[model samples]
Target: MNINIKFPDNSVHQFPRNTTPLQIAENISSGLARDVITASVNGKLVDVNYPIQEDARIELFKFDSLPGKEIYWHSTAHLMAQAVKDLFPEVQVTIGPAIENGFYYDFDKDVPFTDEDLEKIETRMKELARENLEYKRREVSREEAIEIFRKMKENYKIEILEEIPPGEKISIYSQGNFTDLCRGPHIIHTGKIKAIKLLKISGAYWRGDARNKMLQRIYGISFPTSKELNQYLVDLEEAKKRDHRKIGKDLDLYSISDDIGAGLVLWHPNGAMIRNVVERYWIDKHLEADYKIVYTPHIGKSELWDTSGHLGFYRESMYSPMLVDEQEYYVKPMNCPFHIAIYQSQKRSYKELPLKYAEMGTVYRYEHSGALHGLMRVRGFTVDDAHIICTPEQLYDEVEKTLVFSLDMLRDFGFRDFKIYLATMPEKAVGERQNWDQATESLREALHKNKIAYEMDEGGGAFYGPKIDIKVKDSLNRLWQCSTIQFDFNLPQRFNMEYIAPDNQPHRPFMVHRALLGSVERFFGTLIEYHSGNFPLWLCPIQVQILPISENYEDYARSVYAEIRQHGIRAEIDLKSEKIGYKIREAEVRKIPYMFIVGQKEKEEGTVSVRRHTAGDLGSFLLQDIVKRLKEEILTKK
Candidate 1:
């Protein structure tokens, strides 16, 4: 029998049934056959060697594609596991999976894997790849799978086998002397992986549960060419230099102290100044956008959480309740409940529909110590949260406006590149199907209407509703999820929220929860990395630094500082008797945007030598003219 296969270019071809995707690629061109790593048969990803059984749409994936990379890294993980097992007979493989950048395999071993062991593993992986081992898959019954693992004395594999449903197909893949249980569409052969590198090794809990035994996890990356691998390594090194934790400490922006508790950030004067500027700008923007800002308590009664369904659905991340006058009060994990309360305060009418309430609400959440990192993941942080309660007719417009506002704000902060994701309802979600569909459509329309390109994340939305998640690319080209515009049909219904309609009947108003900067702490962390400590003039804590060449020029430096400060520029004088070069170097290290070097010539001429950090000297300018240029640059946020 012959089958019709539709290519991505809309070309249709007739081929015999059971013809593999690789054969199709070969028929097209030998170059394509060599380049194709995987294929999607009727939208389901499969190996390039997968047989074409019926009429289908076949999309071949190259090494550069996301699915292709995932398959490549996943196969690399198996290769790594095989190498580890070959080196250490006693080591047991628990689980291994592909991450965003690479892959990691966790091992249940007596001793931790060392750096020396990593070198051995990489050597073994390369040797194994050169062997050109074929990956063959076989399906087995659940009992057969259990028996196979039991014979191998792999307890982790047996435990995994027990979780498989009775009638489900249990597939295992074998390559060379190594065989493992996997549901895979792996590469046809190990030779496909050419260049391999073992990045690092770390400790991880079995299945991410701290209660489980700790396992040694080895991270690695592989590429078809050595050039790609080398480039990736270069990016990794640059990423370390831009690490927010290191920059945060170097700049004295923020700190996480053991005494204050982990995952809790203490912003120093420098960080606080930046935060103040961001807050002021945020408030001013919200006001201009016709959003009424509000303040809510950090703790709310247990009854309030119950009404919001947080006690039922989101209790795990919430802190334990405290008893106050026999009533339990819980630290707020979200500001939605309080916003709902405000809506319910008065009997709202249709005239009051589309009410927008914004807040820099601080909320607490219980984060695992192992999961916490600098400001990105914290126990307590302020969310740039807002709720827009509007009529169903106003939902689309509000969502579109919210998206536009979010992009404008992010752009103002120097984020030019953005990737938007429209996340739809998940399998376990609240709200009616109609409400979910309406919410998802609103987000889709918003992105489409704005001519913004986005990817659809099916079943990746919050339990309450669908959302538009905007991930901004930093200076390192790494994506960070910052803004979210979400709909909340569950909360409004749970709280029995209603408004008087035009027909004089009570109706449920649609609620939208938006966080332009998801969290102030996380956004600040991203900004630190994005700017690499050299902030824009308008956002810099100290816009200008006055340096005196010697003790004789101290008076002139002080005068210069005073003059700049009078013009509302954040100016500081380095009054210490340090050498001019040393003072200038210190100012540059501090990432001060401008340094006014005052010396004998400047003191006599009543002019200052201006030096821009990272740009070197800009010659000498009169104090008044320099102030005008500085003000203009700062105002323009250049």
Candidate 2:
């Protein structure tokens, strides 16, 4: 019998039952077969050699796609592992996995890998790749797999095997006398990987538990061609120059202290000013959109969390509860439950069905110290959170509005490229199946109606419900998840939240947890890198710098600064008695958008010489005229 295979273009063809993707690709065309990196059947990723035994929807990927890149990176990781084993016979590989940028492999070796070692390993990997070694998979019983690892003295592999449930099919892949346990549909041959680079080495606790032995993890990147690899290396260097931690310190924007704790951030004055501007703009926009801005306490009764299911599902990330008045209290990890409590404070009706509550609430979470980085990953941060409680009839409209608002908000910040995802219900989810299906369909329809393209994340939704996640692309073309519009089928039912409907019967209201700019701290860090510290006029903390040609023009500079301040420009005057050139350089270093230079010629004329950051000096203009231009630019958000 033949199986009906549906291609991505919605075209279907009959194929032999045991025919593989490789065979199908060859039958279609030799060019497609050569270009195809991998294929997915019914949303499940599989290698080109995977047999198509049943009717399925097939998607073929090339090197450019995300899934294809991940598969390629993972295969390179195995090649690197093979190279290490050949170079250092004593080194024992534990686990290697592909990440966002590249791949890393952990090894239980006594000596840490050095720079010289990385170079040697990379050279060996390239040599092996050119050998065209074929990858062969062998399935074995769990007991037999454990025995194989035991004979090889691979303790980590044995530990992994012991944890697997009984009767689960186990397999090992081998290429050129090197074998390791894996659940793989790897590329057919090593020759497919064209370029490889071993980046660096770091220590990682086995299984992420500090108590376990520290293993040396080697990170690397690979590409199908040498040119792409070279481009990625160039971008990698540029990323280092724009590192947020270095920029933060240079501009005195923020700091993370060991004394205060790892993941908590201290926002310096400059950073706070930026945050204040963002918050004010956020409030004004929400108010214009008819969102009621409200405040909630940082801590809530433990019973509230228990009712919201946070205690059960999200306890690992939440802080330990403290006893207050003989009852437990938890620092809120979220603000939605508190918003629900406020709704419960008064009886609501169908007329008030679509209630939008917005807040700039700070919440605490527990992140491993090792994972903490500058601003991006923090324990304590404010969330630009909002929730919309609406009736079933209004669900799709509300979702669409939230999506549009999110796009507008991001656009105002100069983000142009967006990648949207519609995540459906996971296997382990709460709420009725019918409700989940309806909510997922509503989000899908909203995306379609708005003409927004999105990918379906088959099971990427929270356990509570489905969601729409929007990721903004930065200057380096890196995607950052900033906006989320999630349905909450669990909360309304858990809290018995309802609004009286037109039929005079109480009905559970649909709740959408919407966050644009996800976390203030993370978004701020992203902005620092996105703008390269040269923020737009409206968001710049110090919009203008007043520089005097000499001490003789100090008074003139002060007057210019004062006049600009009166016009609501964020201005600073150079009072260090430094040369005008030095002051201008200092202003440029700080990335101020504009600079006003004063001299005797300009002071006598009541005019100031202007300079734009990263640009040369402009001709002199009357101070009032310049102020008007600045105000207009700021008002227009240029």
Candidate 3:
């Protein structure tokens, strides 16, 4: 029998029914066969040896593709699990899956796996890979699966099979002496994995449910070539060096204390200063863009959230309501409801359409203690949030302005590359079909109008609306989720928001909720890692640290510092007991963009020796000339 297979590029090929992706790759080229790691048939990741029995779209994935890397790492996880079973037969494997950078496997065991155990597992995995074991998939009835695991004393596997819905197909992957329950898209054989490393081990909740049993999760990574694995290890080291938590501690920027509880951040003086600059820039930009600055209370009546549907959808993350005079009040998790109330204070007309309200809104969420990490994932943070209430005719312009504004803001802060995703409506979304269609079209048109290309993230929108999320890429090519523009239809109807049309009839206004920097805390964390603590002149808390060689020259250093400070530069005088080189090195470590060294000669000549944080000594300059150069760097607007 013949089956038509449509390639990712829409080209169709006829192949015999039950053909495998590996066979297809071999037909293309021996080199492609060697490089191909996985395949997706009609959007489902299946084993390279899995048979395609019917007409479908086939996407052959290499290591360069995201899905291909996922498959590679996932197979490595299975190998790790096999190794663990071989060494510790008492342990039971529950689940193993691939993540962003690698893969981890959850094991139900009496004892936790240690670093030595990880080393042994890595060795066993290498031995298994060298055996060139073929990954064979077998399908059995659910009852038969349970019986087989029960006979083997694999209670965990039996439990998993019992929990799965009846009538669903049960498939298991077998390699040599090890067999496990899995739905996989593994490479042709274990030998395809040439390089592997066990990274770490941690405790995880079984099935990710805290109420369930705990499991030991072993994390690992793999590559087709040792060179690629070596490069990955190097990148991992660089990422560790750039971790914001480490930099925060070294630079005295922010801290998370055990006494203060988890998910709460305490910003030091320097961090506060940087935050002030960021907020000031945000306010100035919004004002220049004709947005009205607004403020809202941190807490509001519980009824407000109930009306906005947040109480129903977001109750788990929200704090319990406070009772005052028998009425419950809740801390704000979002600023949207309050903004809507303000808009309702008075009647609006079509002429006042596209009313842009911008705010630095602080919100609180009940983040889990274990999940909290530095400023990147926190419980409390301020959002540089805004809402544009516009007529249908104004939707395009509003979205376009938002895109341009966000891009310009990122570029100004040293982020030049970004990944964009246009998310359409989800199956569970509210609003008329026509409304959703029109809103998605408006967002699409706006992106095209600005000449910004974006990929479609189908059904990846919020429950109330479609949206576009922009992930900014840093100097190290790390992607951080940032600016977002969400189009909401349910809010206007739920809040009864309206504007009088030209014909004097009240009509529903389109609501656009957007945030350029997303959360200020997350942005700060990304910025610290993006530049590795070397912030630009504009955002640097202490742009210039004046180092006086001795106590005698402190006065001259103070004078230069005051002169720069008066000109709106973040300048400071360091008069600590330290040598000139030591002080300079300290300032460089702190990531101060500029350092001015003051000595007897500099004081007598009214000159300051300048050094850049990243660049070495830039020679001496008159105090005024040094200020001028620093000012130019700060004022280089996007």
Candidate 4:
């Protein structure tokens, strides 16, 4: 029998019924066969060695592609697990999975892994890789799989096996003497991983449950070539230098205190200034764009959350409710419910079909102590939210407008490169099929109309509806998720939202929950790292520093500062007894956008010598001329 294989470009070719992906690649071209890492058979990821049994859509992946990299990293994770188990006889492995940039394996060990232990384990990995052991897979009945794990004393694997859906095939992979229970499509051989680097070690709770025993997690990355690994290491170093935690502390921007508890940020004066500037501009632009600004309270009754279905589905992430007037009140994990409450407070008509309610609301969620990062992952942070209530007839236009506005906002903040994703409805989802189709189509058409390229995330949407996710690429070439325009059919239905139509009939309002620079703290952190702490002129907390060459020019500096201040520049004057070079150096250290050096020559000439950050010694310019230029840059966000 013959089977038809469809390529990603919609071309089909005939092959034997049991021909493997590798064989098909070989039949096509030798070069393709050499580079092919794995193939997606009928939308399911499968090994290159797996036989093609029928007509299917096949997309072959190489090492550089995202899917291929994930598979490659996952294979390396299994290799690492093997090495660790070989070195530590008593240690039991839980799970090892691939993550962004690398892979991590959790081990049920008595103590945490040390540097010396990592060195020995990594050495063993290299030896095993050199042996070129082919990873062989075998299918077994569920009971037999359980028996295998039980004999190996891998209790974690057995627990994972118990959770596997009934009728799903249970498979085990073995390379050398180590075997693991995984529904895998791993690399052909250990030799494929040519370069390896064990990044770090950390403790993770088993299955991410705090009540479970903490396990030692070893994080690492591998590459097909040594050059790629070296470059990644260099990028890692650069990332450390640009780390927001270090930059925030050095600049005295913000602090997360042990006293105030983890995950709550204390924004210092500098950080607060940055936030104020962003909020002011945000409000101004929102008003210009016709978004109605609204304020919602920090806490809401448990009944409110219950009605919103959050207490049922999202209780784990939410903090315990406090007693308020004999009722349970929760620190809101989101602002959508309150926005819905506002809409419910009054009856509406089609004339108010597209009402956009915007808010800069602070909400709190319970993040485990281990999960809290500097500002990126926090318990409490302000979100720039906008909920649009519109009729089905207006959904398409509203989504398009929101997309344009979101893109514009991100660009204004100096983000040029973007990674967009159009995520469609998931398997277990709410809403009618017609509504889901229309909502997904609206998002798709908006991207197409804007000529924006985006990847399709199949079945990756929220249970409520489809969404468009925007991730901005930072200077380090790392993608950070920022803007989102998510449709919510579930919320409107749960809240019984309604707006009268022209025919005098009540209809469910289509709800869109959107945000740009989603979290203020996270966005601020990204901004800090994006510019490497040297913020752009408009966004910089301290825009200008008036450094006098000496106390003789202090009066001149003060005058320059006042003029700049009048022009609405964030200016400051240095009056400390320091050398001219020292003051200039200090100004640079502060990452001030501009430094006006006033001396006798410049003071008499009615000018200040300019020293711009990133470009040293911009020469002399008239105070009025410089001020005009500064204002333009700030206004234009240059």
Winner by TM-score: 1
Report the alpha-carbon TM-score of model 2 versus the true structure: 0.78
lDDT of 2 at 432: 84
lDDT of each: 0.91, 0.89, 0.88, 0.90
lDDT of 1: 0.91
lDDT of 3 by residue, 219-301 (tens): 88999899999999998888789888888899899998889878888999888888888999899999999999999999999
Which 10 successive residues of model 4 have the least lDDT summed?
Answer: 472-481
Return the candidate ranking by lDDT, descending.
1, 4, 2, 3
Clashing pairs in model 1?
none
Query: Which model is ahead, 1 or 2, in terms of lDDT?
Result: 1
Q: What TM-score should be assigned to candidate 3?
A: 0.81
What TM-score does each of the candidates earn? 0.82, 0.78, 0.81, 0.78
Clashing pairs in 4: none
Backbone collision tally, model 2: 0
Q: Which sections of candidate 3 miss by over 4 Å?
A: 1-74, 89-100, 106-116, 132-174, 180-194, 202-216, 224-231, 423-441, 448-460, 472-480
Which numbered prediction scores highest in lDDT against the true structure?
A: 1
Tens digit of lDDT per residue, candidate 1, span 247-326?
Answer: 99999999999998988889999999999999999999999999999999999999999888888878889999999999
- Candidate 2 per-residue lDDT, tens place, 1-638, comes to 99999999999999999888888999899988886778999999888888889999998888789888888888888999999999998888899988988899999899899999999999999999999887878899999999998988889999999999977889898888788898876777899999898988999999989899999999999998999999999988887778778899999999998999889999999999999999999999999998999999999998899999998887888999999899999999999998998899998999987999999989999988777777888999999999899997888889999999999998888877778999998887778889899889989999999999999989889889899998865544566678899988899999999898889999999899989999999889888887788788998889988888888888888888888888899989887778788888999988888988888999999999999999878889999999999999888887
